[model samples]
Target: MNTRQIIIIALLIIALVIPGSSLLGEKEYPKFLEEPWDHSPITVYIDEQNTPPHYSPSYQPTVIRALQYWEKGGNGKLSYNPVFELANTSDADIYIMWVENMEEVTGAEEGVAGFCRPMIANGRYVHADIVLEVGDYKGYSWQQYGDDNMEQLVTHELGHALGLGHSNDIRDIMYPTYEQRENLNPLLVQTTYPLIVISILIAIGISGYLGVGWLRYHKRRKRLENELLKEMK
Candidate 1:
């Protein structure tokens, strides 16, 4: 092909490639996807002493709201009390604690924002511990995980506590990574799969159109050359 035609083809290919790369997302697998909790309205005990950074009386309610987010997200499969009972008993269903660092959660753990460890007995869940990190670290501004970020993380951990698994879809609150969504504690998921499908179809249609046009152009050019040669002959 001529230089101009080659340049145009290269530009189209690059434009298609970059967007597909961005659309490609990491597929994270869930570690603890067991059976659903056997009971409804599971009990949760919060360690009030190790509260989120900049603790205030109002923070507890926000945390409760985070728990309730699951109730709505559960869609009748699971539920938690709107009111968090006081931790008078040691055997609460779920225990949420805030640690100063990942090291406290696990001796050598680093770079993780939080994690959920489930207690299993006789192939069933007994309890779960969910820890959130709020401690300051040098060169790590991770302590700043606040607002929707922290609340969403809370819901995600609760999902684990309920024997749920991580979601490959980033729009899901149960996604492994900490993603900031437009809406906090989403009950309905808007997926990109449909968009991806539509884009592929459009790209294919475009390519087919371009190919047909190129063939027609060559055919027309050959016809013109043949007619010119006939006249000369």
Candidate 2:
């Protein structure tokens, strides 16, 4: 082949070798995934004394809702079905408490709503402690940020406890700064095998029907010829 034809052939081979899915840039966020908790239906303990002022008991429902949101938001590699149970901090896989100085732990100049401390071992998270610091922000509370905003913040911190890191997309719930409610896209699944199985069954049924018709036609033809020959003889 000429030089130009050889170059064209080389380009075609390279294009065929590369996977189309890799070009799409679909990747899960990091941290919790490294050492995800193996247990299912994990329980979280909420400290009654460590709640935001005017937020205890009344705002507890919102915490449950946030846990459910993160549970459904996972990519299925790690499963979370968190059940909130009231208890002392010592006996808990996860703790949801309030802290007056949010900036001290998070190192943010302002608007540090909440943060989490994950206890990791063997490349997986064993437990975590989350703190919400609504008191640190002036004029901010469940009344000011509203139920929706609190839910967003709780969901974000819980995600960290479950082994997820921050995301660059502001819309994602895992983002460092909570701007909006967001969820990760579920992993894509292939339906090709089911479709192929259905097509094969349909082809077999049609072939069986056609074979039966052909046999009946030939049998009738033979009987008619035999009668005609008897009459001619």
Candidate 3:
């Protein structure tokens, strides 16, 4: 309404602008293939490799959890039937495997997590396999995330296998670059949490500084008015 109020509002808005503004430009919303999965609740099988330097007891469970997270996290956009836990058969719409070797694979770069290769037929994705990096790679460690990047790896590849392309959005699960996301919500892990806190702190600091100035101005104005009144008397 007034100049001081407008300044405060502008400062607060600027403080909060970083989170949403970063998502603007180029507009690659829902980057996807020509065809989506032809069926509901796509089935997935994990080819668990239980060998030294490649296997952990947590691997299988973590894979299953990633599958389940897909079913729940996407707000009904995805459904997964994890068949690997029940049987050894890798017969499913999607197959997930762990590997330490990357020399032969296409996109398994050093420090890379994994990659997805989908088989398409009749303009539809028929089958796909996700190869995940196991153990440490290029001296980099997986000390973060409860599942240790496994969940994000599977989830990202699953998005591709389901006919979705990599998202430009940093907070998206299908973001091309692999960022350390300890939380299921990528926003919190990627950009939202610390930035949001910083913005709030900035807004508070600005308000406090302005408030102090306004209080000083008010005191000075009141004292000057009393002096004027005394002079008039």
What C-alpha lDDT, on a 0 to 100 scale, does residue 87 get in candidate 1?
A: 64
Tens-digit per-residue lDDT, 20-135, candidate 2:
32332233333335335766556688777655454545445667887777656543433445444445555677888765446655564555677777676665667778777644
* lDDT tens digits by residue: candidate 1, 1-233: 57887677667667766665445332223323235355655678778765655444444565687876765554233323333344645578788887656565555344566667777666556788887765436584545555566676677777767655556666767777742221221111112333344345445545564676555555555665564444333
Model 2, position 182: C-alpha lDDT score: 22
Q: What is the lDDT of candidate 2?
A: 0.56
Kindly report which residue stretches of model 2 are placed more than 4 angstroms away from their true locations once superposed. Answer: 1-28, 52-56, 74-90, 104-108, 135-144, 179-233
The candidate scoring highest on TM-score is 2
Residues 71-148 of candidate 3: C-alpha lDDT, one tens digit per residue: 565423333332223335677778877755443343444545666777766656687777766545345544333375
TM-scores of all models? 0.53, 0.54, 0.53
Whole-model lDDT values for every prediction:
0.56, 0.56, 0.56
**lDDT for 64 (candidate 2):** 83
Give the distance in Å from residue 201's predicted Cα in candidate 1 to where it truly belongs.
Answer: 35
